[model samples]
Target chain A: MKRKLTIFKIGGRVLEDEQALGAFLKAFSAWPELKLLVHGGGKKATQIADQLGFTPRMIEGRRITDEPALEVALMVYGGLYNKKIVALLQGLGVNAVGLSGADAGLILAQKRPAQTIDFGLVGDVVKIDSLRVHWFLETDLTPVFCALTHDGRGQMLNTNADTIATQLAISMSAVFPTELIFCFEKPGVLAQAQDESSVIPQLNAALYERYRQQKVITDGMIPKLDNAFDALRKGVQKVRITHFNQLKKGTHITLE
Target chain B: MKRKLTIFKIGGRVLEDEQALGAFLKAFSAWPELKLLVHGGGKKATQIADQLGFTPRMIEGRRITDEPALEVALMVYGGLYNKKIVALLQGLGVNAVGLSGADAGLILAQKRPAQTIDFGLVGDVVKIDSLRVHWFLETDLTPVFCALTHDGRGQMLNTNADTIATQLAISMSAVFPTELIFCFEKPGVLAQAQDESSVIPQLNAALYERYRQQKVITDGMIPKLDNAFDALRKGVQKVRITHFNQLKKGTHITLE
Candidate 1:
C-alpha cells in the first residue's frame, strides 16, 4: 500500500488575510501525513505592480506577463508571500521549505508558443522531476511552492497555480496515493450562485454535465472543476474543493 | 580523513554581468566536489526599491532595513536574483537549490536591538541548522543561499552576506574540512589602492595587522579580512579572497 500525500492549493483570499493565513497554517502544520502547499498570486502583486507604475496587460481575461509584470510576480509570489508563509510555518513547528520549480529543477516548463495572442513569459508544464520533492518529503520537510516554473534553458515562466497543483498530483500519484485539495473563498461548488449554504456535497463528470445544463456552475468555477476532475482521472485518489477552514468538509469529487 | 568542502561567497559585480556569471558558473559546474555558494545583494534591490518609491535610509554607511526596505530586500535578494541564478546554474547542468534562511529553517536569527540607531528588521545570526544543508549537499544539490534570514517567530530579517558566509563556514566546519572563498570584483587585496597588479599574494594575521597599521588595508576590506581570519580560526581549513575568475589564484589568508 502506498502512503497518502495530501497536496493543498490555496488561493489569494486566504493568503491575503493575516489571521486566516495563520489559522490555515496552524491546522496544516498539525497534520502528520506528508503534504505540499501550492499558493496563488495575491492582491499584493497587483498592488505592487501599480505602485511600480506597470499597468497589467490582459488578453481574454488572462494576464499577459510582460517583463515588469514578470518582475512583480517574482517579487510577490516567490519572495514576500512565499518566505512569509515559510517563516510562519516554522514558527508553528513545521519544517517548511519554500520552492519555485527552478529551485531544484523540481518542475520544468516550456514557454507557451505564440499563436493568436502573445503570452509573454507564460509556461506550460512539460516535465515534473519528483526526486527532490521526494527527498524533501521523506526528510519531513513540508514544501510550499510558488506558481513559477523555469524553462530548462534559463527562463522563469509564470504558471497557473491550479495547473501546477494538478500536474504535481498527477505526477506524484505514481509514487504515492495523492489527495488534491483546492481551497478558495467559497465552501464548495455552490448549487445556487450566491448561496454559500448550497454547497454540492459530491460531484462527478456526469452530474457536472447536468449542472452545466442547469446553468449552475459558470465562469471561474468551471475551469476549477475541470481541473479537479482531470486530477481524478489521472489517478489522484481524491479531489476536494473546499474553503481553507473547511478542509475535510468540502465537495468531494469522484468518478461515479 | 575529513572530506573537503568549498564555500564560495560571490558579490553583485560578478552576478550582475551575464558573461561573467555564466563563465563563473561554467567553471563552478565542472568541478566535481562538495561545494556551496552564498551570494550578496545587488543594485537590483535598490533599483526596485526606487521603483517602488522607498528611499533607503543609511547610517554609518549601512542600510537601515525598515519595514518597506525589508520587503524590498526579500523580493530582490531572495526572489528575483536568487531564482534567476538557480535557473541559470540548472541550465549549466548543475543541480542547484536556491534558499533563504527561512526555507527549511536553515538559519535562525535574532532581531537586532537598537543601540544608538534602530536598524529595523535587521537580524543577527543566533543559530545555524546544518542538517538540511548537509542533506542537500549529500544529495548532489549545490545550495545557493540568499542574504535573508528568519527570526523563527514569523519575522524575516535582512542580514549581511559576509556575516552569513562566515557563520555558515564556522558551523559546517564541524562536518567537513572547509575552505571559504570570498569572490568579488577586485583581483585580491591590493598593495597600491588603484593598481590591479599589486595583488597581495599571501596574507596572515601579522601581515594584516602591519597593513592595518600602515593604513594600506582600510575601509571595506578591513571587515572582509576580519571575516576571513575569523573563519580561519574557527576550523575552516583555508580562507581565500579572490576574483571569481581567479578562484584558484588569489590571496590566500592564513593564521601562521
Candidate 2:
C-alpha cells in the first residue's frame, strides 16, 4: 500500500475573500493526510494591472499573458496571495512553504508557440521534478504553490492552477496514492446548471460524455473535466470537483 | 575543518537595476562554496505604495510598515523581486529557492511593541531555524530570502535584509564556517565620504570608533557596522562591506 497524498486546487474566488479563505484554510489544516495546495490568481491581478496602466489583452475570452501581465501575475499570485496563504496555514499550526514552479526548478515548462493567438509568456507543463517535491513531503513540510512555472532558461511563465494540480497528481501517483480535488465556488458539477443542489453525485467517463453531448457541461468546465479524466487515466487513484466548503460532498470522477 | 558557507545581502539599489542585478547574480552563481542570498525591497515598494494612494510614514529615517505598506512589501519583495531572482539564478544553473521568514517558520520574529511611534507591522528577528536552513543547504538548494518574517501567530512583518543576513550568519556559523557579505553600490566604507577611491581596505573596532568620534562614519554606516560587529562577536568567521562586483576587494571587518 502506498502512502496517501491529497492535493487541493483552489480557484481565485475563495482567495479574494479573507474570511472565506481563512475558514477554508482552517479546514485544510485539520486534514489528517499528506496534503498540498495549488492556488489561482484572483481579480487582484487585474486590478493591479489597471493601477499600473497596462491594459489586459484577451483573445476569445482567454487571457493573453504578455510581459506586463506576467509581472502582475508574478506579484499577486506568487507573492501576495501565496505568502498570505502560507502565513495563515502556519498560524493554524501547519508547516507551510510557498512556492512557484521556478523555485528549485520544481516544475519545468515549454513556452506555448504562437499560432492564431500568441499567449505571450504562457507555458505548458513539460516535466515535474517529483523527487525534489517528494523531499519536501518527506521532510514534513507542506507546499503551497502559486500558478507560475519556469522555462528553466531563466524565464517565468504563467501557468494554469488546475492543470498544474492535475499534472502533480498524475506524477506523484507513481509513488503515492494520489487524490486530486478541484475546489471552486459552486457546489459541484450541477446537473441542472440553475439548481445548485442538483450535483451529479458520481461522474464517470460515460456520464461526463453524456453531459457534454447534452450541453450540461460546456465551456470552461469541459477542459476541467478533461483534465480530471486525463488524471484518472494517467494513474491518479481519484479525482473530484467540488466547492471549497463542501470538500467531501462533490462530483467524484471515476474511470468507470 | 568546518565547511565554508558564504551569505550575501544585497540592498534595494542593486535590485532596482536589472543590468546591475544580472551582473551581480552572474558573479554570485560562479562562487564555488555553499551560498545563500538575502535581499532588500527596492524603491519599487514605495512606488507601488504611491500608486496605491498610501502615504509612506517614516520616523527618524526609518520607514514604518502600516497594513497597506506591508501588503505592498509582500507583493513587491516576496513576490516580484524574489521570484525574479530565483528564476534568474535557475537560469544560471543554480537551484535557487525563494523564501520568507514565514516559509516553514525558518525565521521567527516578534512584532515590535508600540511605543512612541508604532512601527506598525515591523518585526525584529528573535530566532533562526538553523537546522531547517541546513536541510536546504544539504539538499543543494540555495535560498534566496526576501526581508519578511512572521510572528508565528499568522502575522507577516516587514524586516531588514541586512539584519536577517547577520542573524542567519550568526546561527549557521555554529554548523559551518560562515562568512557574511553586505553588498552595496559603494566600493567600500569610504575614509572621505566624497572620495570614492578612498576605500577603507580593512576596518577594526578601534578604527571604527575613531571614525565615529571624527564624525566621518556617521548615519546609516553606523548601524550597519554595529550589525557586522555583532555578528563577528557572536560567531560569524568574517564580515565585509563592499560593492556587489568587487566582492573580494572590500573593507573586511576585524575584531582586533
Which pairs clash inside model 1? none
Please give, for residues A1-256, the per-residue lDDT of candidate 2 as tens digits: 5579999999889999888898889889998889999999979999999988889999998889999999889889988999999999999999999999999899999899999989889999999998888889988899999999999989999999999999999999987899999999998898888899899999999988998999989887899999999999999999999999988889999999
- Backbone clashes in model 2: 0
TM-score for chain A, candidates 1 onward in order = 0.98, 0.98
For all candidates, the clash counts are 0, 0
Name the lDDT value of residue A43 in candidate 1. 91
| Span of ten consecutive residues with least summed lDDT in model 1 chain A | A129-138
What are the per-residue Cα lDDT tens digits for candidate 1 across A1-256?
5568999999899989999998889888887789999999879899999988999999998789998898889889988889889999989988899999998899999989999988999999999987668778988889999999999887889999999999999998888889999998889999998999999999989999999888898988888889999999989999999999878888999889
Model 2 agreement with the true structure over B1-256: per-residue lDDT tens digits: 5569999999999999999999999999999999999999989999988887889999987778989899999999999999999999999999999999999899999999988888989999999999999989988999999999999989999998989999999999998999999999999899999899999999999999999999989888998999999999999999999999888878999999
lDDT of 2 at A30: 93
Docking class for candidate 2: high
DockQ of every candidate structure: 0.81, 0.86
Residue B207 in candidate 2 has what lDDT?
A: 94
